[model samples]
Target: MRKVLWIILGCTIASIGVLILRHSHVVTGGTAGLSLSLSYALPLSFAVIFFLINIPFYLFSFFQMGWKFTATTIGSVSLLSLLTSLDHLLPSFTLPSLMGAVTGGLIAGLGLSILFMNGASLGGANILALFAQRKFGWDPGKVNFSFDFLVVLSSMYSIGFSKGIFSVMSIAITGFVISYFKQKIALHNQPTPASVTQPLDNAISK
Candidate 1:
């Protein structure tokens, strides 16, 4: 029952995020931001574009992040896509860039936090981050930041440098919040290695 509730909540948050993006006419972060850019230039739907961009990353996630994580990501991605499609039926709103960026970041970050707590991801550069962790043990957040920088750079050429800069800032804020929650959850799950190793060292000396 608890799992079911969490799943429902996750879906709801994901949908609300889609609505936020649609209503605001702004891009969020992650693969979704790239998708938004492509959708703006092309005729593709946001969900379809997102799915296509994400499919290749699935193999990386499957091998590095494991099945449970991959499955949750797939489900969340699907939910986000459906919400994007459904959102087209509703009336859209016009929001200014600054308001859109901040609101989009907050909603999208909160939704991603719920997804992360459930052991999943949105699966774009995030998949790239997992691969980096597997190969070099690099911090996933750092890897994500590097890729986000690339995405925002492209946004500068495609849109304008100012919007791209704002998007970068918004993403930075969102990523920081999500990383903080993730670290807190990780600490809650187990003792820090420094503490555990100290006890072991004392035992060995004794």
Candidate 2:
């Protein structure tokens, strides 16, 4: 129950960041950014594009991470899509480029870290990152960053060089934040060392 709420919260936070970037005409990395880029050129909306792009990754998540993870990811992605789709209801304003990148990237990164902590993801590169982290001990954040960088770079033709550069910085900040969270989660789950003579000490006390 608590976990579900946390996932919802994460989704909301991520949606807000997406909204920020969208209005700023900036995009982050991953399929989220990819969808955003596509939305700029296509007549479709970001929500629709994002959900569609993630469909294939759901299969990847199910096969690599398991049904439970895949289910949670689907839900999270849906919730985020729904939330961001509501952008039409709000007053519109664009933030300065650097401000939007830094702010949106950080918020989205923290939200994503929470989701990853709870075994959920936004799919696409996120699924790959988590799978590699669990299966091969790769750093999920770095792997994620690499994937994001490529996707964002590819979108440069649409978003232009200046926005693409800012997008890179945003994803870099996001990746660093995610790496920090992964390290902290790793340390938190490490077993504490027991005294070597604890059995003898217990026997003496008894």
Candidate 3:
């Protein structure tokens, strides 16, 4: 129940971030960016594209990350897709390009951070990133950043050079947030030395 709530919250936040980027006509990395790029040439919506693109990754998630994580991720991605589609119903507004880039990036980063901490993700590169972290002890953020850079670069022709650059910035911010917050969460969850030794000390005193 708690996990479900956190996943919903995380997906909601992440969808809002995606909405900001879409409203500003910007892109980010991962499957979301890929979907955005495809949306230009295809007749389908970004939400549909995003959801379809992630389908292949589920096999990998299931085999590598286990059923529980894979199920949670599917739920998270579905909610995000639905929410992002609903965003189109809202009244449109404009934002300055620079502000959009920074704010969108930060917002998206926060959303991704929450999803990651909760053991769910937006799928695509996120699944790969987590798998790499678990199998190879790699830093998921750096791995994600590397892939995101390539994804954003590939989008240059579609979104124009300037907007693609902004996409890169957004992904960079997202990667930083993932790395920083993961570390913080890890440290927070780590058993303290005092706690570990308390049992021994109490036994000795007794």
Candidate 4:
């Protein structure tokens, strides 16, 4: 129940943050950025673009991250898509580029953190990052940042150079936020020493 609540909150927050970025005419990274970029060129909505882009990654997560993670992620992504669509029904307003960058970054960071901590994800590069962290001992946050960097660079053509720069600011802040929590979670999950988990007698004998 707690996990479900957290995942829902995460999706809501993420969808709002993405909407803010879109309305500001800016972009971020990962599948979100890709979806945003494509949405600008294509007539399709961001929700549809986002959901479609993540389909391939869903398969990756299912095979590498297991069914439970993939299932939760699929649910999270689907809900986020639905929530972001609601933005169209609301009073339309555009945030300034700078304000959108900072605010969206913070909100996205928080939402991504919540989703990750709860064992859910937005798929795409997120799935790859987590897999690398577990299987290769890499820093998931840095991996995410690297992927986001490439995505932003590739998307500069679509969003224009100036907006891409702002997008960089957004992703950088989001990366920092994710790295902070990733470190804490990694430390928390480290193996406990025998002396800590074992009885004194057992420890001394061992």
Candidate 5:
């Protein structure tokens, strides 16, 4: 039941995010953003490109992370790709580029936060972060930020300098917000004295 609920919720949030991308004409960060920018220049579906680009990362995640983590990542990535494809069918509209940048960033950040909290990823840099953490034990947040930075830097030609700059800012904001919430949640889930005492009492009783 929980998995089903997450599936439904994840797809819904991701679908809205893709709609925001379509309407705003603003590019995002990571592989999805790259796919969007390239789709503008080619005859490919953004979702298809997104899924294809993520495949290798998913394989990396499976080995470096674990099956449980990789399973959730797969579920989230697959749903996101499917929803993005379906979102294109819903409407054809546009919004101001700035508004698109802000709102799209917020929605993407929040949606990804939801997935991340559930032990999943929206794919791309997050998977790479897991690999980095496994190999170097660096902070995953910093690793993900660096990945986003490189992705944005590579976009100068495809998305132009000005828009690429905006994308960098948007991605930074989104990543900061997402990491903030995830950190808060992790803190909340830490063992408290009272909670820890209850487990000790149970063990003594047993």
Candidate 6:
């Protein structure tokens, strides 16, 4: 219950970040970035592109991460798609390119961190990142950054070079946040030597 709410909140925050980037005519990386780039060329909405692009990744998630995680990711992605589409209904505004880049990246980083902690994701490269981590112990951040570079590079054609550069900055900030927090969480989950010994000592005393 609590976890579900956290996931929803995370998705909402990340969607808002994407909305900000869209309004500023900037892009990020990952599957969402690919969807944004496509939306520029096609008449489709970002929501439609995002949802469709993620469909194939669900199979990877299900096979590698299990049904529960896959279902949760589906829910998160769907919610983000709906929210991003509905952003059209919100009052229109704009931000300076640099500000938009930094703000969007920070907000997205925080949101994605929350989703990851809750065992949900926005799919696409996220699925691959997790799979690589599980199978080969590759850092998810590095995997995501590699995919992000390709997606953002492709966006240069749609969004132009200047915006693409900003997009890179945004994703770099986001990836750093994800990596830093993920590592910290991993360390926190490890049993300290004192903690291990304390339990054994307690058992011996009993």
Each model's TM-score, in the order given? 0.74, 0.84, 0.83, 0.83, 0.75, 0.82
Per-residue lDDT tens digits for candidate 4, residues 117-155, read 666888898888777767776777788888899889989
For model 5, give the RMSD to the true fold: 6.3
In candidate 4, stretches whose alpha carbon ends up further than 4 angstroms from where it belongs are 38-52, 187-206
Clashes of 4: 0
Per-residue lDDT, model 2, residue 93, is: 81
> Residue 79 in model 6: shift from native, Å?
1.0
**Where is the poorest 10-residue window by lDDT in model 1?**
197-206
Clashes of each: 0, 0, 0, 0, 0, 0
- Give the lDDT ranking, best first: 2, 4, 6, 3, 5, 1
- List residue ranges in candidate 5 displaced over 4 A: 35-52, 130-142, 184-206
Number of the top lDDT candidate: 2
In terms of lDDT, the poorest run of 10 residues in model 6 is: 197-206
Which candidate would rank higher by TM-score, 1 or 2? 2
Better of 3 and 5 by TM-score: 3
TM-score: model 4 vs. ground truth: 0.83
Question: Each candidate's root-mean-square deviation in Å?
Answer: 7.1, 7.3, 6.5, 6.5, 6.3, 6.3
lDDT for every model? 0.64, 0.80, 0.76, 0.79, 0.66, 0.77
Candidate 6 global lDDT: 0.77
Residues 52-76, model 5: lDDT tens digits = 8888888887887678778877787
| C-alpha RMSD of candidate 1 | 7.1
Model 2: per-residue Cα lDDT at residue 169: 85
